[model samples]
Target chain A: MVEPVTIAVDVMGGDLGPDVVLDGALQALRADSALHLALVGPADVVEPFAAAHDRTRAVAATEVIAMGEHPAAAVRAKKDSSIVVGCRLVKEGQAQGFFSAGSTGACLAAATLVVGRVKGVKRPALGQVLPAYARPCLLIDVGANADCKPEYLVQFAQMGVVYMESIMGVSAPRVGLLNIGSEDTKGDEFAQKAHQLLAASVPQFAGNCEGGNLMAGDFDVVVCDGFTGNVCLKTIEGTAKTLFKYVKDALMASLPSKLGALLVKGDLSRLKGKLSPETYGGTPLLGVKGAVIVGHGSSNATAVANGIAVAATTVRANVAGVIADTVARAGSATPGGEGEAAASDAR
Target chain B: MVEPVTIAVDVMGGDLGPDVVLDGALQALRADSALHLALVGPADVVEPFAAAHDRTRAVAATEVIAMGEHPAAAVRAKKDSSIVVGCRLVKEGQAQGFFSAGSTGACLAAATLVVGRVKGVKRPALGQVLPAYARPCLLIDVGANADCKPEYLVQFAQMGVVYMESIMGVSAPRVGLLNIGSEDTKGDEFAQKAHQLLAASVPQFAGNCEGGNLMAGDFDVVVCDGFTGNVCLKTIEGTAKTLFKYVKDALMASLPSKLGALLVKGDLSRLKGKLSPETYGGTPLLGVKGAVIVGHGSSNATAVANGIAVAATTVRANVAGVIADTVARAGSATPGGEGEAAASDAR
Candidate 1:
């Protein structure tokens, strides 16, 4: 018997509007027998769908936070916004998790402020799975803390280790510090210090991994400050787009090549599907007290449903609880009794 | 008649050995009638070739700095090393420029210490062209200085502007700060301060460019701290390799796809040729007093020849002198009298 997991779905979020999210909600409900969804959006938008669905209900949210508005400001001002309402559901214990494909900033702000942070966790980081070769690698702090202390990275690594083990099903995740070179003395002051802390804290630390190894599937988890991680993630996205464009141009250049393109079109499309974010569902907001999955703003129906599934899986795995414990252990084990040690002491 | 250009080549520098560099030297000598080569290496490796070829001479250096050796230490310890000898040629005005496929760190160290810095330049940066869509974009400080001041970035932009205009023939190149976000307020303290300096110092500043925009060919020049720039460069390289592997796998999955792959093989090869680093030749050691072109360690004969051509072009354009003037002008135009302005004042 599977334990039932209820997740709040922000239908008013993604770029495709309510219809796509609603469609995805239905798909998710059909796929998971023990999954329940609280469709969060304007009353008129979600009311009918909730009434029709068996295990789903409507959660009224009056306002919508646009993608362009300021994240913290918009989140604060739009009290009845779907992102805020979805987070509130998790905080109120009405939903075990929250999923949104909205503005990342708004989602992050609402989740952090409303849902709160896990005990012993200094900062909640965004851990995203890079669609790498052979297997995917999880990159933490994709865009949470622009400036991170060494202790914060240690916390991130602890959370990442738990997330990878519980949700990703890896026996023991290999952690690598994202840096310019593999050597400990290779980068700026921040990197050198971070390297020392990570080596001391993470038992599975695989030294430093360069940017080129991010998609090489050599390590299970790669940790870096949000700024570097964000740039790295976006660079991969941009590079993929640019390369595919080049491939398309090459295939369309001559008559024989066009025939070749037609023949291999289906296989290439399937390859794209495997590498797409929709396949991974969403990025988990680790170190948060509740299960929060933030999808891409451009997510479609399949992606939304995948996000819900990921949220449910995260909820079932008790990722937040595990992260809390892991962080406590790491904090206690840290040398010099820094901020992280103080956090553990408070707990 | 074209003015003669003399470039000292580090014959024993690359992974492919002196034979490859000698072959490239011969090819370059044949291609450009006015081009002269001063092959710097062990006597046995370069002497016979130089004796046989017209407009070519051997400058023997007994020692060879291995790629794995510490950059500054090797340069300081081995006075008669090929890299040191090559730089000495340019310093003594025996050669207009220096070209090498040796260790980047060693090349940078020798160039900065021996060849010297252009007046008013605080730090000499390594700027490489990213093979982007439609055209290429110049990325400065790829791996020269791990940490950079705001004024250093301004200097990088100024040097980038001169390189793009003179070599790439991009009139009034658009400069962009490689940051996590497009917003001015986004990123850490370093980025924020750099943004302010770039906007004020560079008239052609295009605001902040995210990592995704790197290979989009949207901006002609993107500047960042050496740490960030190095990671960005390697990540792109890694992502390209990963994507191509996926493409290859997809093409080999089935019989139909295999046939398609066969048909498109030639066109794809040509496309790869256009995108390869060989096309760009080498990364210029910008801000240095003399022309220094650092080729890839794995560079073959063709790549070596291309590097020599780029060095010849750099010497002809007097890129270092232009950068000096540009830096002085920018320093004078700056709002506050910082280190850059102090440099200009000293000049």
Candidate 2:
């Protein structure tokens, strides 16, 4: 049998530390046969997992940045920090990619600063897959770059298009710019200018999309600046949390409603399955030199495995290469090219 | 007792028409003693409600607007349209204000064209009270003017602040520009230009606010163009709907979780009360000469009652007058007041 590809795991990442991180990594290993792991963190953090299960599945790359430390400072000071060490393994070619459930800020800093950007990417973006009605719609720049030029969004659109196609198997995904309305003049100054820039510079735009259409699956890929996308994503998450309480209260307030809720429970679960943040467990930091999947900090065992699988799938799909290749082909539409893409979208 | 002020209600509005509208009107009368409703529609629609309920509290202002008719075109064409008839009552001092659960486009058109804007008010805005952990937060220009000028957002800030202080009882509500980020220079051209104008003109802007802080209770009044606000509002609504499904599935996943849900059901309901769309039911179309509360077409009786209460509260608190007075005092700032607020921010 061929030797399995080793993936680097940021063992010190996440709020619950090694317990949740270790639980997730172990579960991930069980789910995938061809994957081995380089678990990077303090010895104490990595040793317990090594003692419990198959030591053959993971090798410790010990040391870590404290959760409270500045991400950039930590990366510089803590040379062996879990996030740094994990990304370093990929940089050194010992591992294909890395997965982390830690400080999104620090993780992003290390990923770009260490692993670098793809060949012609103008700016890297944190691309997320939202579980909409028809299929998972990918929204890029969830919270990486706050300031976005029209050209940056165009680059993000191209990169997001490639990631969705290669990793998710979506072909010729319709690209849409997230805006207040679908009309050309309906957005802020940037959107209006971006519309002009996109139509003239980029060929993939499916036109403008409203926020209400997120669930309606209006397009395959939704492109926006990180600030707007992050706000949109988190606002949705907050609203979902808020609405869950309301619907439950409505159902339980009366006997008839409760009975109806019970009858429809299976349908409800199926609907939930279609929308769970866990089903698509990780958001890929696209346009990076290497694959970096940012898993939810609150993720459990199943989610962690899913995140690792996502990173591996991205690596396997050669997403970064395709992204670099696509932008290179796009040419002058992207002026700064790979160098601009590498640094502009960092935390 | 002195006669209650009449509120002209459009019975022909909304998907359910007179039945739900009448139900909501009756609910409103029962909840508030000062409510005198002038229910407007054809005799067929209003006569039934008058027959079943005490006519002393409700009067039929007979007229009807066809659903498919154009709002502005219909208001001018169909002089007998209920929405127009209702606005006429407010114009003639037969009613203090108006409320409609009809076509949003129709309601705003009727209110603006019929009642008109306050003197020197170049633009009017729809200010919505978004439920928050603290008192409800106000966001102006939800969908009033699709296109916004920098001067218009500044005007909205002044009006939104008055609405918050008067109706929500927030004293000196921290006003903020809803931008992609907190930086003064961040966001699109309009936002950047508006930042300069707001700093120059408006008095209480707390500085630039990122989209993520919309719920964090940082600003009492968050101002953005209609397009961005609509997108942000819809995104929040969509996300809430999505999360609502996830929680239901989690609670019903197994027997123990279901049992746990039982104990926590009351707490869940209380939480729902804070987040429900009904808590802050109506959005006041600010800058109008008279009070006008626009309830959503999907609103239930509770939401309708809350809308009535909100209109009554704004009028009662003299919200519009406060805005008129504030602008008068700050009128000496400059032609556009673009640099006045900026000078203050610089301090």
DockQ of each: 0.55, 0.20
Residue-level lDDT of model 1, residues A149-259, one tens digit each, is 666787888888888898888888899998888777877666777788888878989889899899999999999888888988999999988988899999999999999
TM per prediction: 0.97, 0.75
> Model 1 clash pairs?
none
lDDT tens readout by residue for model 2, A62-102: 56665556667778776767888888889999888899988
Error of 2 at A47 (Å): 7.3
Candidate 2 lDDT for residue B146:
53
Residue B62 displacement (Å), model 2: 14
Best by lDDT: 1
Q: What lDDT tens digits, residue by residue, belong to model 1 across residues B94-147?
A: 999999999999999999999999988888999999999988899998999986
* Candidate 2 per-residue C-alpha lDDT over B1-347 given as tens digits, one digit per residue, 9 for 90 to 100: 53456677777766665778778888878877877777788776777666776632344545566555566787887777778888888788887788886766677787788887776576778887886544567877887775566677888998998888787778888999987556687665567778887887777888887665776667899898776677778777666654555565666777755765675556556665666666786778888767888887677777777787677666667666777787667666745653333321110
Candidate 1 C-alpha error for residue A167, in Å: 1.2
List where candidate 1 sits over 4 angstroms from the true fold.
A340-347, B340-347
Number of the top candidate by DockQ?
A: 1
